[model samples]
Target: MSGEVADPKPGKAQRRRLSRSLVIIALSIIAGYLIIQFVGQIDWGQVYRSFGHVSWWQVLILVGVLVLRQTLNAVPLATFVPGLGLNHSLQNDVAANVAGTVTPPPGDVVVRIAMFNSWNVNPVDGMAGVTMNMLNFYAVRLLAPVVGLVLFTVAGLERHRVGWALLCALGAVVLMLILAMVLRAEDWADRLGRGAALQAQRFKASADPDKWSAAVNKFREQMSDGFTQRSTISMLALLAMVAVDSMILLLALRFVGVPASALSIVLVIGTFFSAYPLTAMPLFGFGVLDAVLTAAFVEESGLHYEPIIIAGLAIWRAITILGPLLAGAVTILVWRRRSGSNLNLWGSKDTAPTLSEA
Candidate 1:
């Protein structure tokens, strides 16, 4: 044998990690390319000039609004997670927001479970809370377009968009009905779960229908009480967050010198709400949504306003992305100090139970 033994073949977990890394790298390259293309099409000089119009006081006001928005965002999670105070929920929400922004899927999930573990929360309960928050959030997002369409009609802007909004409303209704069925009856939950597993099996051969059925039943049981009692509060909190988000975008547009004569507030709100669903996409629909919004504003307000539209969008994006990142850093540090322990971001010894364990 050679003096240096050949490196042992990578294990299954190592292979999985390598595969995920490759996928992330590929996605990053694609997103970067799209960003470059988007930037190339915009008039940066005009956008910069538009940005100069924003005063220091206006920036301060925007920051204040952003803080409130972040606070409201933590409410739903706190409402759902029994014994998790607003302060801890804020920490958890902020940290997970940061992780979700920088990494994909399980990144946020890991941060959430780890934080719950540090706080001595039951793992199953934490997961159930997180799941409810997501479901409620998405349900509200789907309904947003309907609200927008109503506003559009009220403003007498246009009626041609009605068809699309109707489709979105229908989807929301279907989603709500299915969720209600799952929560109201264990049999329905089991059937739904097994059906989902069968569909999943198309992609992953190892998907077990019986396990999925058991998991869904457990999830329904875990969530029913909180969903019945606290769901209204959760929904309201999310709606308030959406309202604040829209307000920030509107303020950015005005501060950047986009006049109402060019684009009315009603139109702005309608378009922004309609586009809100795009946030479900990767990186919160970074390049794609930005481009879409800019194009919509330009089409409505004329191409002359494109530069200011881009500038306004830039401000909104920066606050929403950066505010959470900075806050999350502080929250993570506080969590470390309060817990008096270094928690492993990836499943620590004290980490709460995972879905499989549940």
Candidate 2:
């Protein structure tokens, strides 16, 4: 027994690890190819020159703003989760962001639950808080275009853009109203969920209206008291986060020599809001969204500022996207060391919490 030889074949866990690694590799390769193709068309010399006069102090200021932006981003989580302090929330938020960045679907949610468990927080509370934070964030995100539309209209900017903004604003308003009704009235929430479940059962026979309705009512009950009292403050914090994030982009553009004459702050904000939804895409919509922003800037500011626009977008992406990923990775390491566990994103039996429990 002491001299027993181990099996040469990999176990189920090993196989799962191999498959997950393969998936990540495949996605990364595809993303890299797309990004390379995009960069191939850019004029690097102009991009380089654009950064030539950017002062060290300017870079420091940008870094400060970046830190502030992340702080604001963490506020909603702290606000929503009881007994979770700002420091813990920041760590948890960044760790979850990393998970969300890498694997799609339930990876982020699973990591969040595990992190909460590590902190001795209730899994249900964690789930509710995360959901509330996301809803609030989306509510603000959708509503932003409406504000942009108002500014554009007030400035008498292009009429063509107004129509698209108007459509987006209408959609946002409808969504907000629905969200309001669901949050305000448990009956409304139950009815909506039941209706959705019934509609789904049309396509899939397994859908159960009773289960869906009960789940909706449960969620509403859990969130109703806290959300009702703190909705205004939470919304304001998230709104500030959005404003600061947009300002980061503006600073990036201005620092790269894209003057106010070529592109006003309003135009920059407009382009940002239009492209913001794309951030929901995988890998923070790295290549595609970046291309959209660059193209939009070039379209608005003309061909002469194209190089500057490209350079500025790169800076902004590095700050908002790459910076978070890197920070989140480091935070994961710290969590692992502190928790005395690996904190596996794939939810290993030994190291991670199960989705069923959540």
Candidate 3:
């Protein structure tokens, strides 16, 4: 009777909170960028030319690498929790997880939860595991920009745009704050959803409040246990994902007939930090991606973006927006036929068994 509520309809305030988060990120990046462009003596030609390249094969490889990056995410995700009735096959989860990663609203979260739910796991408990996994993910991601910031400064990348370095640092700090919230989530979830709290502790007997309290303690303990067990694997998987992400852009660079050095790949991916550029969120890295990637590489590596920018950005858009959308559509059709009905979100079954003697 204790679990996080499975996808409670967001209240108006929750929607506002989500929107505000996006706005803050967007404005900070945009405003900072404009200042650098105008006040900071940025090379407007470099900014403009970064997008005009053409290399179809390299672009194809780039798309493949992006898809591969998403696939790598599945490794840690599936490995994160143990003994949950994971409904889908490992292949399916990886494909869906990849598709999920290309778009967001935490639709990635939805895909993962559904995979578990299909196995008869309670939705709420699955939700908590998924939530915790994301908390871990964001915590890891915070490293991207922080590392970028320090590297950029030491390596003189900041000479091109102090604003860019600052934005990366800001994102890292925000992610750190989110990580803290995730660590102490149950304490906060207690306030957000009494219903969620009940579902989180689905192992206790008697359906009593006291039982729920005790089970909540156990739930947190189990979560910590899972983290400790998988920390090494999780960290490795994440690093692999990041590597795959960098390679995708490298693929794009190749497509544009440009050969990027090891260090250049590091900076472009760092500035363009997120994997989900196709999300509906306004700040979801849409207008900024092509520009910053081209500019950053040019600034650091003395590369020309004219041909690279056009071809590379085109391929990125195709895979991120079209590829995943098509895959998800296929998943929907197959899942419907199999389940004999449309299953929108996934979850696990949660039922309290009679208290077993300790």
Winner by TM-score between candidate 3 and candidate 2: 2
Query: What alpha-carbon RMSD in Å does predicted model 2 have with respect to the real structure?
Result: 5.0
User: What would the per-residue lDDT of candidate 2 be over residues 169-273, giving only the tens digit for each residue?
Assistant: 677678767877887798899898899999999899999999888877877776777665566677787768777888888998999899999999988886676
lDDT of model 3 at residue 16?
74
**309 in model 3: Cα distance from truth in Å?**
2.1
Screening candidate 1 with a backbone cut-off below 3 angstroms (N, C-alpha, C), the clashing residue pairs are none
lDDT of 1 by residue, 216-235 (tens): 99989877774656878987
Residue 121 in model 3: shift from native, Å? 4.3
Error of 2 at 92 (Å): 1.8
Question: Using lDDT as the measure, which candidate wins?
Answer: 1
What RMSD, rounded to one decimal, does every model reach?
4.4, 5.0, 9.2
RMSD, model 3, all Cα superposed?
A: 9.2
The candidate scoring highest on TM-score is 1
Q: Model 3: per-residue lDDT, tens digit, 77-187?
A: 456555552334333454455535443344455554555555555545555555555655655565555545554566666433446445645765685454344345766
Rank by TM-score, descending? 1, 2, 3
